[model samples]
Target: MNFREFAAKNVHRNVKAYFAYFLSSSISAALLFSFTMIILHPNLGAIDLPEYLIKALNITTVIAYLFLFFFVFYSVSVFLKSRYKEFGILYIIGASKKQIQRMISIENMIISSVSALLGIIAGLVFSKILLAVSGKLLGFNALEFYLPVKAMLITFIAFVIIGIVISIFCSFIIKEDMVLKLLKGTKKPKTEPKTSTILAITCVVLLTTGYYLSVTSSTKTLAGRIIPVTLMVIVATYLLFSQLTIFIIKLLKRNRTLYMKKTSVLWISNLLYRIKDNTRMFFLITITSTVALASIGSVYAYWRDKEAQIDRSFPQAFFFSDIYDNSSMVDEKVNFIEGSLKNEGIKYTKVNDEMKFIIPKGEKDQVVIIKEDTYKKLSSILYLNAANLSENETILAMPLTKHGRKNVVLENIELEVASKLDKGIIPAFYEEVYVVKDEAYEKIKGVKVYFNTINVKDYKNTLNISNNYYNNFPQDNVNKYYNNLLKSGILRATKVAYGVILFSAIFIGLIFFVTTGSFLYNKCYMDIIEDKKKYNQLNKIGLTFKEIKKILNIEIGVLFLFPYIIAVIHYIFAISALKYAFELNIAVPSLQVIFIVLIAQIIYFIIIRKNYLLEIKKSLL
Candidate 1:
């Protein structure tokens, strides 16, 4: 048969084995195509969104494509290792080294072409659904969906070129000495593998240092320390699997009593070889999985913290402000906004109030004073309790009367404390504010700040309204807060940009996880033949089928659980540092991410273990 025919037959025989890698690659292509569809959408120009958002979307798409290259490279490398013995047999039958390389290269090219084609077809099927969801999040009222010819062309060309480049690279990986290694593939080595004591100690030291640095770095220095800490952790993880794990296994073997226990004997007998052979694979999986989980967790935590931040920074949707003496000067701007909201048929309620601040004639300091009615209205909006105030009674807003002082005296006006509001009433420059009856507020002599807050029934309508208001009455020294520009701008950008980032992080994280699973799946199957031979020999020595199955469960369980445990510990410390940096309580989000990752791990472990045991059973028969 011709080389193409031979490779085609081989691929057909191994189609089931290649299914996971094929599906993951195709899905990755579809996701990339979806992002590209958004980029190519004509309606983006029709919408009035921030330039940074568009740029961020573009940058993230490119990053996804770049990530695909590395993902494909690693996956292809693992695949080549599994096929080494097959290639060695062909070489033994007088196939020239160059000929063998050519055949292998051609086979991979076929797989790549087919995988990419499947991906493009899947992309065509799902890109529109993804785009529609993305458009909704980005506040696009109507994002036109059409055939993304440019995206298709780009994806096809990019993946095709990647295939070609990787094919050439894979050809060179087979050297003269590699034939002998391939010939002995999956065979038991003459000598047992041993761990280096110094390397094991280094693992402990590096991991401890990495954990310390990750947890203790101040927010100011954390950004600068990211690279060093990441390197330390990666090196430590490698040593953990390669040296520390092997050392521990060797210690377990030396413990005669424990080693002789039920299943322990079988586990130690099998695990010693398994750990030695899979250490490097375990290290790779651990690091990659940690990165994926951490990326998703951090972004999710940030997204969750935004709501409280928005509330703190912007108490009301649209609040107008000016000196009370210049209330007339700001009347036109406020009237314009009210008229515009009415013209748009938008429902809103207005609160008109003046905050009186007492500034001593010779001093630069000021203390805010809120009238009783104003305090009640603003408190309702801010979700704080507004206590009834007698003429002499006052409630100090948060951070002001934190000391629980019963009496507060401002500018010769003495008032008894009724209660303290833990949150801000309006966005104020000073945290200290006093609540008093209208009679007391009107009696104080100070500058008066006029503020009018327009509360919308729905914040979603603010984008268009705020846009139009800015277009007409732009910010000036006298009309600084006229259109509520600062708060509205922040609201719009956060909703759009953060929405995209969080979505992208989740999408890419799942892809990384699938690739991690594919790696483990292929590795598990590749070792099945060796496991069958060894276990079949054990069967002759009176090991029953049930006992053998139990041994296999322990073996696979350790393999799967070790990396996940280490990764979770790494992520927990990473998030704790982020909590300090962002100054927000991330406990809820952290727990959520942990739950998600653990569930996914458990599901994957169950599937792999089931299939692995089936293979071993078949081998035993």
Candidate 2:
């Protein structure tokens, strides 16, 4: 028989179990495809966003791909382990390991091709949907046909390569083992995780140091050093999950008083057994949960911290009105507010200033004569600066700040000059410690200060005054004054980033929810099925399905909540990441992201509980 026929018949043997992997992988593939296209596509994404943001998205896509790849390989390995006896039987029937390997390869190729095709197609369609959604939020028109052939090709190539490599490696390991060993491997008891007080203390020290460095600004080179520490923490965390989690569960189980008093003991023990096979899945899930929460939390943090930056940018209040005809004058409202402040006995500091004049010192201060020629019109012996000297010649200079700090001479200014400052302003005036004399300022004609900033009582009152004036205007005028100009692009980009993160959270959460619950139920349910006789014996001793299911529901909920706790810890670490990169300060304790995570856990547990209850009731009947 052909591989298709062989797969068609035998694939259903582990239907509920492998189905979880199939669905989870398909969803992951779809997400990965869409994200890869959006990030790497030269023409896609926002033009106005910071270039760093696009680079960050590319990094995120790579991280997601690595996680998905691990889970896919893990799932395949689990399948091989579960069906080792089946492979042994095939060997007994005179099937060569190489022949069996070929069949397995062909079967995997067919399944993967179908799934990737379906997934990429769905991903392409979803890309258009998200594109339109993102475009509308960004205030832009979507391209008529957004899918690119090159993108699909890359995704297909990636999926196929991963499948082939995993399949080949799997078969190699199986070929090394004899049928006897293969069959016996299935019955071997699981080895519990090894943990010690020393290891636990070490983990705590590593995590605490990492988290402390993350939250505080005391650490320098946060940019350069974070990578090494982050990698270290990730390793330590995995080691903890592998060692400490099982230790905790075993300890809880050994406490007979605590264990026998409730059903948590049974669920914890089952979770410990599942952990061996599902370790990678749990780790990936924890990372994704962290990423999902950080994505939304960052944007919310942006808005909360908005007011703080505005204060730094402008420290004034009620300094003006919309008296555009008199743009430079102090408004009557400003005077009135000052009077009110005086009446209240409030000593508000007021500094009115406008002094911006340019002067010429020498050839260095003369911008006009020598440096004016265009590159295309340049002739021989053209010099960048007025002073022509050896290449080794050097000079020093300083720059001025608005705060009036003495200019520190970082470098000397350079310019071409016709002669001494017979005329007024010059280029060197732009450079601080610019040796331009006061006489040059007088010579410079018609150079006027742009605006006088009168520092006032409160910045918000000034903003409020501006808003009230604008609100009084008609609709079209408001767009002309503000919305269509200053803020339109900034809001669009921020909104898209927030939306993408939130959408991914919900999508990935569902994928995890369904996969974890079904995978667990599929494994646990099989044991429950075989134990039908045992459960029947229990029923004979007077335990009802309701009592059993109630216990099961509580047990499953606790079990589902287990990895989620670690996921949340990861989320907490992710929060401080933005502090090192972008200033993210959200007032909310990221409680919303945590809440969404909790909701996902509930959904998964509910699904597991429902399946277990249905089976228990049916078995009782």
Best by TM-score: 1
RMSD of 2: 14.9
Candidate 1 lDDT, 230-264, residue by residue in tens: 99999999888878988998999899999999879
Model 2 misplaced stretches (Cα beyond 4 Å): 1-3, 36-63, 124-128, 136-157, 190-195, 205-213, 217-236, 239-256, 262-281, 303-544, 573-583, 613-621
Deviation in Å, model 1, residue 151 alpha carbon: 2.6
Candidate 1's C-alpha lDDT? 0.75
Stretches off by above 4 angstroms in model 1 are 139-145, 186-232, 304-306, 319-332, 341-422, 425-464, 474-489, 577-592
- Top candidate on lDDT is 1
